[model samples]
Target: MAGREGPRPGGRSARVQASVHGAVQALMTRMERAEITIPMIAVEAGVTPSTIYRRWGDIQELLADVAVERLKPDMQPVDTGNGGKDLLAWAEQYAEEMSSKPGREMIRDVLAAQDGGGAYQCCNFTKQQIDVIAARAAGRGEAFPEADAVMDRVVSPIMYRILFGEAPDTAHVARLVSGAMGLVSKAPASV
Candidate 1:
């Protein structure tokens, strides 16, 4: 059943993607990310190995897709009429998620794949969240934080600590977010 040309919307391709995605999540619960193989996923997904290879190239790519689908922050940016407070809330949530067990595992897997010379290509999910917050702030006539500054001041520190030994607590995250807000507030608005 491999004679189809390009992807057909709402067809077998979508079904396969869903199945594979589900299979990855399911397998992750039982095994380490590095231990999960394409063949194992293929069996769990009920698709052929060739199908997975053709669609995703490798386990790293498939895992990246799965991470994007499942590991993204669940809440939208909060708008409390105060840009700094809104930003702090969002950053705290982001940090908390990244410090969770599943989040740490996902990051370890993705980073391992990348370090192992595999093409694990998920964009910075935190950056996307920051952009949404910035847009909302701008819409409300509040000073929008620069995405880079947020990443550097808030996201980077949380991730660094989490990935290393000590995951920061909520109090620490609040401080980090507050520090980031200070940096953002002092900068001139982007032209």
Candidate 2:
């Protein structure tokens, strides 16, 4: 799909996308997101409004494009040396971030995207992080829930809350994590 990344990854298309995405990010820091318009973004990025419209279709899609980029996992979940702790820490942080104004906006945008590619990408990003945590836990001889189970049991509720104007508190996140952890199957004891 023709996202902020564009159809091609090199040369003018990439450059234009980067410039546009950069422009949107820069704008977000200074002003309320709702007040910003495509014209303003185009001016900041040095592209015409039509360029953005052609690429993203509308403002919501453009925002979703930018939000997906922002939502990408930058680093692996902090290794706490214990599987449950690692997941607890990660889930707490995830809940907080996705509950914030910007985070909430990003989630909404991803859900609003026409092609639903942004939603898929965001889900994949979360699952990848969970998988990493689970893999790391396994390496340490710790039991951890499958990433899918965590996604369904832990992350899904969190997202549902955020989407419906209910930002999850730490207690909520802790409970979700604890519940998800229950899904892990202990490895067979070594003979």
Candidate 3:
């Protein structure tokens, strides 16, 4: 998975990835994590075990890649008619999701992959959501911090508390979002 850039837009590579990812997801639901293997995924996906290995390198990387794909947001964050409220709503939802049991497990799977591509993909997922929030705010003529600053000020702290220490409560999340919103009132406009 080191040099791999992911599947092509449409081709055998994309089909193989989608099939393999679906197999992993399906297998995870039906069997214990320890019971899964490259051969099992290959059979489920109707592909050869070598196909999985050639694309993902190993079972760990395959699982990590699948977890990152599962973590992608299917829809944009909620819009509350106010930029500050929107940020707060998104932060609160993010805190809840990341602190959940499944979320923690996904994070661990991503971290287990040696190449770190899964982690980068997961971070991009968060950053992309923040960018949407910033864009929405800007469209409403409201000022919002750059996506990177919001990540630094709001997201990093929440993730730290989620990954270490106690999971932050709503109040804690509120404060972080408040500070991030205030830190750059006249900040640039969108992501």
Candidate 4:
């Protein structure tokens, strides 16, 4: 019958998947531009409202995934032989990148979704960055028990200040990097 559950005789499944993907992409674009709604997205994608709701379960999950996808690349730390230098450089780059207009806007949108009771993708994204950094440090006979806390101290303030117009000092970054390294240096090596 070519209804919701049943497949069409032709390549309707593939077509439907493509349509859904395109619709999500378009809706996300509109979200970036500051205009986002289910009906508006359905109209833009030329899909029935129920289709998107049915396929994705809801708009929040879809948006959260998209937000997480966008933040993935920025969370990677660069290796520069020296951990402090590398960490500082990465922090500087992150601050610069996230402080930009587009980056700030994206952060705002992502935070909005989170505050509205959706899943917070930022935690997972930051966890990935911390895992990478901690693994590298561990391989070099270092430990980072407080890696997540350190990252929060170094990067979160900058992001928070930028997004909410709060004032945070530059020395905070220095302290965070140094404190993280100090903890790492104090850990015993494996025999």
TM-scores for the candidates: 0.78, 0.91, 0.89, 0.65
Best candidate according to TM-score: 2
Off by over 4 Å in 4: 1-32, 43-46, 55-62, 74-76, 114-119, 143-145, 166-172, 184-191
Model 3 pairs in collision: none
Write model 2 residue lDDT over 1-67, tens digit each, in one string.
4545556769988888899999999998999888999999999999999988887888898899899
Q: Which lDDT tens digits does candidate 4 get at residues 9-91? A: 54865566566556767766556544676667677667788876665455664454455556667436888655566677676
Candidate 4 has a TM-score of 0.65
Q: Which of the two candidates, 1 or 3, achieves a greater lDDT against the reference? A: 3
Candidate 4: the clashing residue pairs are: none
lDDT of 3 by residue, 5-111 (tens): 66568888889989999999899899988899999999999999998988888999998988899889988999898778988999999889888987877888999
lDDT of 1 by residue, 70-146 (tens): 76556678877777788888777777777888887777656645333221233455677788888877876667658
Question: What's model 2's overall lDDT?
Answer: 0.88
Against the true structure, what is every candidate's RMSD? 4.7, 2.3, 2.9, 6.1
Q: What is the C-alpha local distance difference test score of candidate 4?
A: 0.61
Over the full model, what C-alpha lDDT does candidate 1 score relative to the true structure? 0.75
